[model samples]
Target: MKKYIGILGLLTVAVIWGTGFVATAVALDNYTPFQILAIRFTVAFLILLGMNITKIKTISKKSFKRGSLLGVFLFLAFAFQTVGLQFTTPSKNAFLTAVNVIIVPFLGFLIFKKKVPIKGVVGSFVTLIGIALLSLTSSLGGINLGDMLTLVCAVFFALQIFVTDFFVDEEETWVLMLLQMGSAAALSWLTIFITGEGLPSIKMETVFPVLYLGIASTLIAYFLQTASQKYTTSSQAAVILSTEAFFGMLGSVLLLGEKVSINMLIGSIFIFIGILIVELDIPQFAKKQG
Candidate 1:
């Protein structure tokens, strides 16, 4: 039952993050990237701060330092993602950002001397093929500015994942999460000022979407992710979280009316299959024979 509950929580996180693509697109209609991120993270930070007030006071200095570093990585990940959206469609942005799944194994290899499994290599190839099909239009043949920004976002996200993995074992997770949220919010606001993007007066339409991004997508999803990880392996968590892309594609189609072509559908299938190969430990079959 506990395992099932954890799966439900993770699935909910994916769904919220998926819908967040649409919310972000709507919010972007009236706000700058920094302004939108600032609004979202600010609300999320405040909520987290309130919940962790007692624990926040008791966090060790070392934990604060590590959490702040994690926050910096998280800030970079979202900052690039938010800015990239200014130059790209939400569907394209989501798919490109999802490439972190391919990036993570390489990061693990470089940082921890972990062996890259054959299945992971094949999965990476398949995912890249899918990304190509998904991003290419009849008019555009290769990468564009938005795609480039999202690729950079994917790198930062990979770094964020690694950093979180390091710190999760060393610090209180909620305290770490609060610090990360606060730092992201602060950095986003600083960017807003530096870029001369003043906060526009909030409209009724903007209010709900921004709140949803902060509370539902950022805060609650993150909380669930942290909690779920306590009961599951890191690989399992990554596999579950990778479904964010699937949900993002579904939400885009249903809510934003984004078209999914036959090529795109084929690409998505390859991506999912690739992820399954990696997550299910299919490479272990080769090891058994050898």
Candidate 2:
């Protein structure tokens, strides 16, 4: 039951994050990327801080330092994605950013000296092929500025996942979440000033999306993700979270009227299959060991 609940929570996170891509695209029309991030992170941080105030006070200095490092990685992940959206279509951005799933295992192997499973290597190749199919469009032909930035975002996101996995202790989930969100908010606001972009007037349309992005995507989804990870293994969690790309594509089509081509459908299937292969293979390997 706990595992099922965790799975459900992860699916919810994927859906919320998927819709967030559309919301972000809409918000971008009115405000710059940094401005949107600033508002979203600020609201999310405040909410998390309120929820974890007592825990925040109890966090040790070492825990606080680790959490701060996680926060920096989180900030860079979001900042890169937000900025990359400016240069690419949201659908493309979504698929490219999802490449972090492929990057994560490699990062773990490199940084933590973990051994890479053969399943992971095969999954990576399959996912790369899917990315090629998904990204090949008539207008774009090959990679563009937006795609490059989104790819960079994928790298940061992979690092964030690895950092979170390393630093998240049994005692400090809520406190760490609050600190990370607050740090991201601070960094985003600083970037806004550094870029010389002043705060823009907020309209009703923009305000609603920003609120949803902050509360739903940044706060609620993140909370769910942390909770779910407690019940699910990290490999399973990664597989579940990879569905965010599928949700993003759906949201783009439904909300933004983005066209879906035959190639996209085929490519999406490959991506799904790749993730399924990884998901099934890892658990089976674990069962064999047991």
Candidate 3:
């Protein structure tokens, strides 16, 4: 039951993160990327802080260390992704960032010595193909600085998931969540200063989008991820969360009235199959054969 809950929670994170694209687009009209991230994470940290105030004193040093490390990965992922967007097309950035589905297993094996199940490994490739189909409308273009940056961003994201799985069982869930968010917020502000962007001035029009991103995407989605990763294998969690691409495409079609192509439908089908493969433990036979 906990496993099932974890699966559902990760899926929920995917859905909320999917909608975050829309909210982020709205917020971008008013704020720069670093500024937007700063506000979003700040709001999330504050809310979690308020809710977990009583437990704050009990948070262990290990939890702070792990959470802060995870926070750096999270911050780097977003920072590279947003910066990469300036140098590459959104399609390229999206596809490369989605490569986290591919990186998680290897990182898990190398960094944490976690053996990825055969089925999970297969599902990651399947998901990658689906993401390519969904995001790559153009031919493989020349690799640019943006593409490289986005690929690095994918590594950071994969690390974030693996590290979350690493620490979730050892620490208080809320404490980890709060510190991770707080660290990310702190990093974003630092980036804003380093980039000389200064702080962005918020307007009435920006409030709704920033609030949605803060509360829904950062706060709710991230907390769900932290709590849920406790019950699921990191590989399984990565595959499940890869559905964010599917959800994003779905939202575009449904809400933004974007036209869906045959490729899109086929890609979505493949993504579903990937998720199903992991969820159903279809690799048991493969393991037995090995």
Candidate 4:
């Protein structure tokens, strides 16, 4: 029951994030990337604060520290991604960001001495290939400054997932969720000031989508992710969450009226296969020498 809940929760997170791509596209029309980040995180943090106000004073220093660490990674991941998008194709940015799915297993092994699972390892690569097919409209262009920044962004995202899995066991989920959001919100606001993006005027069209992003994408999706990781390994979480790309593709086709090519369908199948490889325990047929 717990296992199914964990996977289902993570799937919900992926779906929310996938839909967020559409909201973000609409929001980008009226706001700078930093502005979007600031608004979304601030909105999420404030709501969380409202929900936890009675217990605010009860949060411990240790909880605050862990949340702060996660916040830093979370903020950095988005920051670099937003900036990286400027110099690279959105396709590249999207594909590179998905690289975190591949990093989680290796990071676990190297940093925590956790044994890597063979199927999970294979699954991640297959998923990456699928992402490449889905995201790259053409051949991958030469690497550039933006590509490097996006890769760094991927590393930070991987850390966020890895650390969240580790810290979920140590801290109250709500406390961790609220503080990390607050920390990310604070950093996002600072970035706006640093970049001198003085208040971008808003309109009804943009406001609605931004609000959706704040509530659904940041608040709900992240809250679910943090909670779900409690019942699953980070590797499984990473692979499941990579389904965000698959969902994003679906959203684009349905919402944005993008046409699906043959490769796209093939890619989606590979993604499904990859997910099965990670989630299902396949029988090994190799004979052992007695």
lDDT of 2 by residue, 1-290 (tens): 99899899988998899899999999998888888889998998998777766766588887777767767888898888989899877777887787877787777788779987777777888987787787767665676678778888888877776666655445356776787788888898889888889875778856988999999998888878776777776666677787888889889999899998887788777777777666575776667556
Order of all candidates by TM-score, from best down to worst?
1, 2, 4, 3
Give the Å error, residue 63, model 3. Answer: 1.7
lDDT of each: 0.78, 0.80, 0.78, 0.80
Compute each candidate's TM-score over C-alphas.
Answer: 0.92, 0.90, 0.83, 0.85
Which residue pairs clash within candidate 2? none
lDDT of 3 by residue, 182-262 (tens): 999999999888989988887776688888988998899988999999899887887788777666656655665657678
In Å, residue 227's CA in model 4 sits off its true spot by: 1.6
Q: Output the TM-score of candidate 4.
A: 0.85
Clash count, candidate 1: 0
Candidate 4 lDDT, tens digit per residue, 87-187?
Answer: 65443455556678778877978987977677767877797777556556566753477767877898999899999998998888889989999999899
Backbone collisions counted per model: 0, 0, 0, 0
Question: Residue-wise lDDT of candidate 1 within 103-138, one digit each (tens)?
Answer: 777878987889888878878888888877866666
What would the TM-score be for candidate 1 when compared with the true structure?
Answer: 0.92
All-Cα superposition RMSD per candidate: 2.1, 2.8, 3.2, 3.2
